[model samples]
Target: MRKTLLTAVRDARSGLALRLIAILSIAILPLGLISSYQTSKVLEKNGALSEIALLDRTRQAAAEERALIQSAFGAVEAISAAASIFDSADIDCDAVLSRLITMEPKYIFAGFVDTRGIMTCASNKERANLSETPFFQDQFANPGGLVSVRPMDATTGGIALNVSVPVVVNDDLIGRFWISIPLTLANDLLGESSDTANLLIFDSEGEILATENFGDDRRTILPQDRSLQEIVRGQQRTFRTHNRRGDLRDFAVVSIVDDTVYVLGSWEPRNTGALTGPSERISLYFPVLMWIVGMAVAYIGTNRLVIRHIKRLRQWMRLYSVGQIDFSQARLQSAPEELEAVADAFRAMAQRLSEQERRREEDIEEKTTLLREVHHRVKNNLQLISSIMNILIRNTDSEEAKHLLRRVQDRVMALSAIHRYVYMSPKLSMVRADQLLEDIIRQLVVVGSADEPENKVSMSTRFDPVELSPDQSVPLMLLATEAAINAVKYCAAANGGKPWITLTLQDLGEDHVKLSVENSRSGLAEEQDSDTDHTGTGLGSRLIESFVSQLDGTLEINALPDRFELHVSFVLVKDEGDDAL
Candidate 1:
């Protein structure tokens, strides 16, 4: 089994399939890989640059917002130092703070905490302790200085940015002044956008101040964003990263202004028109797709053009080896050039073989024709010899010599008829047995009627048309003819001269035939059947026995005082040889 497999693999046609597959794989693989790599690089390069471009624009926007917040916080000092308002007697703190709130809508609250952390000039009578807030404590630690504590909880709205400053009277601490601004204003400042650009502001302490994607149906801030933490810890001014939903990637520019970290970035959603459309995506992976398609095409083409054709060619050559030359079977339609050329050559070679075969057949036919002509001429020659023998028989004085010459004449005439039948036959070496028997019987019946005119012998034939090869026909015919002649000649001597001969020839099945000649003789028994036996030692009788034995047949001879019967049964041949038809 292993040897058979190895042989199959080593076969030329099998190797051709392998060679073609290898060649195509080698040619297409690198091309696909290189093309895919270059295309993806180009796509990614342009995409990152475009995101960075949008990020830069967004960074500028973030900077403007950050400056606004910082300026608002910076102005808190001037607002707190409004001596016209704060230092005035019977100060209406609520009206003044409410007026400031009306002036800057972003300021959610305004108040002053004294050295005891109590609201002295309060915006609201009920107020939270400022000393607990980081910026309020941080301000008193550095008096008259402002502190921003962001990512702060708002009192009534959203997340807030808190800024506080310590107020002093001649180096004596008075209170801490502070204001709160909500980040919702910052979100309102930068409206929803088409790009993946979003805003993020975290404080210096690595706390997430705010996150805003700010688009239709997009989250403003993702809870527990680890990527944001990585950005804050890392030292990259502008870092590139993909979003949590891997498909969308961003290039972010982190800017620090007034102690706030502002991150501006744009993401490219990998799934959503990242490279315009499907054609662009295909271009990015063009090499990979091409490689796959190339492999498929190579396999199918090799099977069709190389392997299949080679197999068919091998099959045809095998048929040709056994003399089955069918040129049309060798045709390979719509094949590759090299294979087609081979098929063309195969067709040409098969054509030559067909022509050669045709010529050989013609030569054989010509030889058969010449052989038939030879038989015709030999028949004519034998008939001439029989005519001469007839003259010798008529001129003879002795009865014994006359009888021998007549028997010899009978033999010569039977041989002449044999040759004549062979000449008339379509094939040189085959003759129809029934026709030869009928012809020979007619001639001998004429002779039997001539010698005894008063007892004219009647002839009846029963036979099938059996095809006999050249060697079988002559011997079988002579044996039958000799039996008929002896019966015809002796019937008068034994049965009062009124002769009636019945010739029986039949297909006996199993490639065999039976020939029988029964004749009435002149005297002796009143009735006799075919099984009745008598012996004769004449030359014709001996010749009949010789011929029958030569034909490998069974001969049954029964000679009664008044009748004689002869029967021979034999097999026929049907192959192309001396014994065949």
Candidate 2:
């Protein structure tokens, strides 16, 4: 029971059951968070709807203010239409203003100002000269256009908008009609907000025309926000609030009334009554926290259960990339069923590779054995041929015929020497080139000088060790032996009588070789052989040329005053029998 418990714990540490637990926790997180998530989304949507409704309210108020301005302009146009209003000399200006103010109670002042900056006809009983006021002085330069001015009130110490229209009759400019109203007229339109939100109105001239019911201590604000500026430029249609600079939760829009721009908005405080206490905020965010924790655990558990083992298996295979493969020594431990199957496949593959290598080694040994037997058979047959030639040479009585027979015997023995070396060496593919040459010259020197030791020719050789294929070495050895035999035969007539022959085998780098044979020769030797039926070289010359061609070599023959030299050079490619071809 204790072993079972330990195994269970190990499995749970990095196995499917732990992964399943992580997955279950992940699945439960969304269920826990759905209510809080929906509540947040609903609150966001309601906030947007409230902002839109507040914008609509400001738009309606602006439309009403536009209508009020048009009414005020119509009142001035109505009085300007009468011919008697321009005849200011006989007019009762105060009586006229009283009648006009009674007609539309919104307009408190109605009078005419002359070019001299004095009121010519009065609308009020307490009318002054009015030349000091900048509001009426601006009318003389622009005779018939409407203008607005903000003049401070004596009693309230606040400013009001004074609108004036130019008064002209029958191409005669008498003065201008003027009307003044307090900023309280704007507050009549914007009543009150439903919540803690406040309303404000401003013109592009940096004047806060009207604001919420700010008591004596209420702080009024001007909407100079970037969003409000964008609205004034007509680039942005509407805007929301941001507290990046200050706590300004004022969602506002812009309205253009008679070339005057107005910003109308509502203000919301930073920490509202909706989301107040710490516990309430925690309840809103707890689900999201649980979701993050659950997903993290699930990812770690799944990586341990499946991904980690896969990575370990990849590491095992990567070892083979560096030419190392040993399945037994690097055996994979127990794993999930699928991974165990992969490990089993790797072991089976390793077994097959070992078997293939063993069979390949056996094949190489068998081929080598067959090759050695071939060379041994060739050597014996050539030796039998050489013995028959020797027997034939002894039976012949003619000296010329015996000389020719000995030459044939020398060629046969050169062939036998190459096969002898191949069969003797452990490797059957190639024979040692230096030993093959030495053996060829050894047999030639012994047989050629055996009967004539009195005129014995000295033989000297230089050799460089190189390996040649059995086929190529046979041709090469024959070519060298033929040149050596010719030198031994020509030595008797050489002028110095110190008759000598030399063979030099040299290696030129990049797998090339040079073979040279030189013997002392004289004009007397040609005269001695001139009476003979065959000149010194008839058949041997042809045989030497054939071997040179077979080896893809170049041969040069030079017969100087007292010497004969034959030089042959050929390329030698190791481990390949097809170098020439």
Which model scores highest in TM-score? 1
Indicate the worst ten consecutive residues by lDDT in candidate 2. Answer: 527-536
Candidate 2 global TM-score = 0.43
Q: Which candidate leads in lDDT?
A: 1
Whole-model Cα lDDT of every candidate shown, in order: 0.67, 0.66
Residue clash pairs of candidate 2 = 93-122, 94-122, 94-123
Estimate, for each residue in 493-562, the C-alpha lDDT of model 1 and write its tens digit. Answer: 4434446788888998888788898887755542333212333455665677789888998888766666
lDDT of 2 by residue, 1-581 (tens): 99999997986687664666666877786787786787577656655665556666556555655565657666776666673654567766667777887777787667666756666554565445656666655556554545354563421135555556666667777667666655577555545333444555555544455554434422334333453344466644344445343555655565645545464655563332232235545556777676667767776766765667777777866775555567676654546788778877877786787677668768777766776788789989999998998888889999889888888888888888888898797666667888888888887888778747676778899999988877678789888887787777776546656778889999898889999988886766664233211224566677778888989998787767787778889998565542321
Which regions in candidate 2 have their CA more than 4 angstroms from the true location?
A: 1-330, 334-342, 492-497, 527-537, 574-581
lDDT of 1: 0.67
lDDT of prediction 2: 0.66
TM-score on alpha carbons, each prediction: 0.44, 0.43
